[model samples]
Target: STRMRFGRGAASPAGVLRAIASGGGTDAFRLDGVDHRDDAGRLEVLATEDLAVEQIGYADVVVLSRADACSPEALRRAEERVAVQNGAAAIASAARGEMRGPSTLEALLGLRRADFVQTTPAKATHHHAYESVSLTLDGEVDGERFADFVETEVARFSGRLLRTKGILAVAGLEQRMIVQGVADLVEITFGEPWGDAKRTSRVAIVGFGLDVGSLERAFTTCAAS
Candidate 1:
């Protein structure tokens, strides 16, 4: 950037325009990127600062990444902030290598999430400093208690919790309960039937500085007792 006469730490205007331009096509999605950590809250895309706001303003989506890093209130504020600049664009939250809300990969790819079979994600080859906990249960869980746990205790640790996704075997529900959460925001939906598959409940939590024992204990307590 220095050699090109742009600010020392800032992106080149031509580069930003060229990159955003490359995303154009009838089938393409114009995404205005921001992070809930700072950029979203500030409603600023430093990389595109020098470029005309109109150049990047025409977007089909506003991607707010790292939403798990912020509180529910913070996320709400970030959305409002982003909307000030890109009010027409749909908002999407991304976390834990998967989209947490609408505008997911499948949606972008023109596919329905329910059309695919849910499977355990393959183990990653690399590891980061964050801690991950996986628990399995052969018995059914108490749906109400699990929902309360997600709304309360689990949400209380949002700052350090990156993601919590699981296949829940609810005591009376015949179909599997699929849950995915980031911070205090969680989405739960009924999935396909167990069929011939074993009735097992598996929950995985990924985060930084997580108290494994406490989380696991509290999690198990949601069992139908």
Candidate 2:
């Protein structure tokens, strides 16, 4: 049998660092609360947060909370900022601490084990100017078309697209499609069925200085015809 231990902390990296150095091997590092800070004092707070992220050296994932209170544009911008600072981390959005399902768990813990011995300390990058956007569709989308759209858009926005994810209703599929992208890497997987519940599409995009209206319109075009 394999043994695993997990640890968490608030506004501090010491505990997490100690956990990583204990030789148990870290499965992942998650930075929560990416959307809760205000712009007025965000610079100082973001600086502290970036330092903590760098100290940890690597984060496998980032979670954005209080997403419901923010506009899609705000969410997208936040994702972009996080991407710029932690380019390798996957970003997920949560509302009132609730994530989608097993997919979130898989994303948080499914990565290759951290090899601290060969890992180099990360250098801090300033991320004060990032922005994001979110979109919600009340209908099903053509799966093939959506896939093509995502691939093209991610490539086109490679430099600015920090993170993108969607829980979608595919026109011919019963199972929900969960789409996630970090920079140019895109992952699409089938999730649990919608069962008797209402089917809808929800997507959030995080990027740098994105044209929110234009992106929203483009996404809307991917709906089934």
Best by lDDT: 2
Local distance difference test, each candidate? 0.53, 0.55
Off by over 4 Å in 1: 1-127
Best by TM-score: 2
lDDT, candidate 2, 1-225, per-residue tens: 999976633354435434443335555653321222223113235545544444222344556667777777877776655555544345566676676332556555432111101112122235434444566677898877777767665456766655555678899889888765544455677778888878887666655666666666777878897
**Over all chains combined, what TM-score does candidate 1 have?**
0.46
With a 3 Å backbone cut-off (N, CA, C), the pairs that clash in candidate 1 are none
